[model samples]
Target: DHLMLYVTNGMGEGIEASLLTNLAINALRNARRAGIPIADQAALADQAVYAHYRGRCYLSVLLFDFDLTNGRVRVVDAGSPQLLRLRRGVVEHVGFEAQLPLGMFEETDYVAQEFEVEPGDRLLFVSDGVHAVASPKGEAYGEAALARAIQSTRLLPAAEVPRAILRELTGHRGEAMPDDDALVVCLDWRGRPADR
Candidate 1:
């Protein structure tokens, strides 16, 4: 099985989300037709965004195509700073440097890269909102807190990781709402069964 996800923000308040949604779908089609990677899809989306929308927006794309026959997991990602990988109760950064978010450069080329994952591992994807909160004390919740949230819940069920992060974020902010829409996605890899 395979999966693709798109998270976009930093747009002016005029149907930006809708445009990004449409952009993702159309870009996927373009990627398949051109035999390119997700980064190319991002470039396609960027061109579409620049052609129609005139606002600054950040688009983060994550695609993982699992070849169940060989236990190979191909992960393609761009424009996201923080991707957490949980393995055996430990959380580590996936360390993907996004080429650039969509709508930044009209001629930019997005490079979709690949990575491998093991069975029973979890990948946590977050939007910019997770780290964009500024407290009255002027401190951003930051990546350290996010790491802790995942570390603390590494042993728990996969469903609880995002909740714990949000809970911690809210606790740190103490009544300050994030300016952007926040999204969290957790993928748990169970691996292909040998019986198959």
Candidate 2:
């Protein structure tokens, strides 16, 4: 019962570091409230602070919450990445109407969207860093690439799609390490059968 979270911050060193860290913290807090188990909160907080202090402008986070009896995902996007949902071989983006980045407001209310995941359905979340990676020709990875990657890996298990996308990114970017941190999270809901 693990829920995965993928986060990525935009360009510029130390620009959105603090805000991203705060967003991660808020996301974790909200997840915990939803009954997700987060080990070593203090350590994570420390790492978040360090990420901000080190001026890591491009921050990406992939977290898995291994508790999903509730079939809900709590997500907080702080100007990071886009979330895509795949069902019956079609891809759709889950739109976040108007939510501010984490840590920007003290009493910010992050709206959590819930999807009744059916068996064999998959969800893909990735940071802009991945999409921002460009080739020597100055072409971006782009949403089309993301969509193709997801479609190609749709048959595979949830865990493998992220890795596949990473591999694809390498080929597209022609580098092992991307300019910005790239994070990916794939969630597959193998729902339980209804009792007679």
Candidate 3:
């Protein structure tokens, strides 16, 4: 009935980040298991993280709740990248306003925006690290380059889309490892499993 997409900011490193990431994952998992509303899941996780880390660790998350039955998606964006939706060969941002990163404050409420998707639609989620990849000339990879890459590779298999995007990033930034962590995820909607 529900599928979820989750990504955390990889800005933090070492033991503290590992522990904080685990806490966040559990918080979100427990909230969903308890049937918490999609809109409030982030807030619940935020409270748990904040209470535990006390501003020592913060997270920028992109939480997506996918309703397979109805072909709708509810997204809570907390300082993550703008979601890109590809439909009929055209790619565009889904247009949701993002709130502050979780664990930054004592009480923070996250609002989710809902949208309908169809078969053949592809959703892309790129991390800040991906955007921050810099060229030898010190230029960031940026959205314009990412969009162009997506457009060029839209026809590839879903599993290969991320690879292609990474290739694009590498092409721009050269062969060196990026200074920050990079994550690129692509979801191709092909209706429900039963339908398939």
Candidate 4:
């Protein structure tokens, strides 16, 4: 069992952003510690944030729980970037129905979706900062560019993928630093040897 979380308060490194981050992290940690089912974990976190911050603060989250024994991953998305999955040298989007960010409402029921992963499959998650990087001409480095970037560097080692993707995004941005914090996480799924 493994829990991976990517959360952003949508505010850039301010005191409020720090508080919101801590709050969300605690809520998520508590939920996982309590053994909440993967499908319901986001809802539990949502309730916590809503109760404390109400409409004042909210979060975009991509939470993934890996059940290694079964070779499955459960994902709960709240207004984060759509996850990318690379398999057989092809990059594909793992689409979700799209849900509102956490704490926007009193009781937001986040839908958790499950997918099966095979050895050699890679999953990528990025923050909006990566998506929002723009060129001098105002053309944003969106999903198409990101997909191409991932494909172009698909041969790199798993640990190098994030930096490689950032390099691609930076090239698109020219000399400008990212206006927002950028985060990229890559998961290389190598099934347990016992399962093989």
lDDT of 4 by residue, 1-196 (tens): 5645554535446898888778878888887889887557778778887898886778888777777776777777787666788899888888876787878798888778878888888888888888778998899998889989888877888799999998888889998767877778887888877734
Query: Can you write out model 2's per-residue Cα lDDT over 1-196, one digit (the tens) per residue?
Result: 5555545453445645556556566646665666534333322433444445443332333333423575655444445567787889988777554344433333444344444566777877777777788986779988888889899998887878899998898889884456787777787877666679
Task: Please state the error at residue 120 of candidate 3 in Å.
Answer: 0.5
In candidate 2, stretches whose alpha carbon ends up further than 4 angstroms from where it belongs are 1-76
- The TM-scores of all predictions, comma-separated, are 0.80, 0.65, 0.91, 0.89
Candidate 4: the clashing residue pairs are none
* Residue 169 C-alpha lDDT in model 1: 79
lDDT over C-alpha atoms for residue 71 of model 4: 75
lDDT of 2: 0.61
For each candidate in the order shown, give its overall lDDT on alpha carbons. Answer: 0.67, 0.61, 0.84, 0.79
- Which runs of model 3 end up more than 4 angstroms from their true locations? 175-177, 193-196
Pull out the clashing pairs in model 1: none
Best by TM-score: 3
TM-score quality measure for candidate 1: 0.80
lDDT of 4 at 7: 46
TM-score of 4: 0.89
Better of 2 and 3 by lDDT: 3
- Alpha-carbon RMSD, each predicted model: 2.9, 6.2, 2.0, 2.1
